[model samples]
Target: MQALRIGTWNLASGRDGSGRSADAATLRAAVAGVDVDVLAVQEVDVGQPRSHGADQPAEVAAGLGARDWRFAAAVAGTPDPFRSWTPIEPPVLRGPDQAPSGPHYGIALLSRLPVRRWSVLPLGAGRAKLPLQAPDPRTGRNRWWWFPDEPRLAIAAELGHCTVVATHLSFAPHTALRQLVRLRRWCARLPGPVVLAGDLNLVGPVPARVFGAARLVSAPSYPATAPRVQLDHVLGPAGLDPQRPGAHRLALGDHRLVTVTVHPR
Candidate 1:
């Protein structure tokens, strides 16, 4: 049996918690700090101008020595302020070898361990516009805006020992709960010892109740600099042991990287 250190982070597209662009080295170190063998990153950029048109996943993957990784694009364009962005009709899934064209935004799975297969689940975008507390691009200060929901999706990688799933759920009132139900159905059909990790956007004790599993890893991850809520997570089977890093060494983004070690079947 193989044990793995798994981690999840909503990177906010390579931007630091202070809203500063992280250089390649800083980006690499941020991921490395978590010290995870397999990582699931959400809100990542692919060929986006804001992130300097860089493939954020590939950059950090190379830095972390992750030989295998996949970026699942949920939308075709950036969800910029005052600009409208639409979901990718079919969505785009890109591997390391593929040169992903156009600016796309989504979640990604990167692993040092080899994966036997890859799959995706579509958690459609919410219709309601919601108010969000975000940073001002010009001033790097917190601001509120009625942001429209973007497309949501999940990616799962089947390793020899276990299948790992990653995603970022919509924050709309009851939409996230509905999405979790669908995701639970999908996980039930997969192989045994399936591990789920990502930002569900559901806080308090809701995830454990909705996901139908004990939270594998836990911490206040949101608002990275001074987190007060646990929006990110890692969930696994009953017998598995969960662990967390002592603390985040860097402000990777608005959410801190949550990690745990697990024995795979």
Candidate 2:
């Protein structure tokens, strides 16, 4: 049986601690350390000013020694006016600094094998409004919060004999459910043997049912310090089993890299 090893990680702006930025060496080391055939990365800042206006996907792909790579920008064009965040310091680079432009953050897929086709699916028309849920520290009561706008996206690619889809869902349950419904419809049109992976932003049976995916027998992949939920996942067709499902302990980002080796029908 042939198996495909998949990995996903949120690079956290490709930055390390001490306010220093992640370089080619650092990115290369991270990917090399992971044992996966394909990688789905989120929160990747491409052509951002703080990242030295570097194309992060290209840089990481080069570092990983991957010949083919594709990126889908969530925020295409200028930065969202509502988001007023700025770079605290400039990044270290071999060349002169360039102004940041285009998508502020987006998703990317890097593969050692050739990708026959790829497409980016918008999660929703615009930012979705969702009820907030936060645990109170003192009162020990759950509080409600509302996020005005959130970016959501999914990318689908056709591999040799299967289709691979990656997405990052919203924190709100309603929003996630809606996105999941759309994802299911999209997956239905794909060929047999489909794999969906990413941060669903929700826990429990909702995700499993909406996507019609079988959860991997793996540990959780959120809050790397001490994971409490399985926010990151890789689901495959029925009867398909993940050879070895597990999570990484590295502090690469808030979310740990969830990987699975699966044998498709």
TM-score winner among the candidates? 1
Give per-model TM-scores.
0.91, 0.79
C-alpha displacement of 79 in model 1, angstroms? 2.0
User: Which sections of candidate 2 miss by over 4 Å?
Assistant: 17-20, 77-103, 125-148
For residues 1-265, could you state the per-residue lDDT of candidate 1 as single tens digits?
Answer: 6778998888888887567777767787776645788999999888876678888889879878898999998777766556445767676679999987888888999999899999888889888787877767779778897788888998999888889999999887499999999999999988768889898999866887888987776578877888888888787778776655322525567777788888776
Model 2: per-residue Cα lDDT over 3-93, one tens digit each: 8888777776676533345765676666666777777888777766555666777777766666566666665544433352332122111
- Residue 204, candidate 2: Cα error in Å is 4.2
Clashing residue pairs found in predicted model 2:
49-100, 132-145
Count of steric clashes across candidates, in order = 0, 2
Worst 10 residues of 1 by lDDT: 242-251
Give the top-scoring candidate (lDDT): 1
Query: Model 1: clashing residue pairs?
Result: none
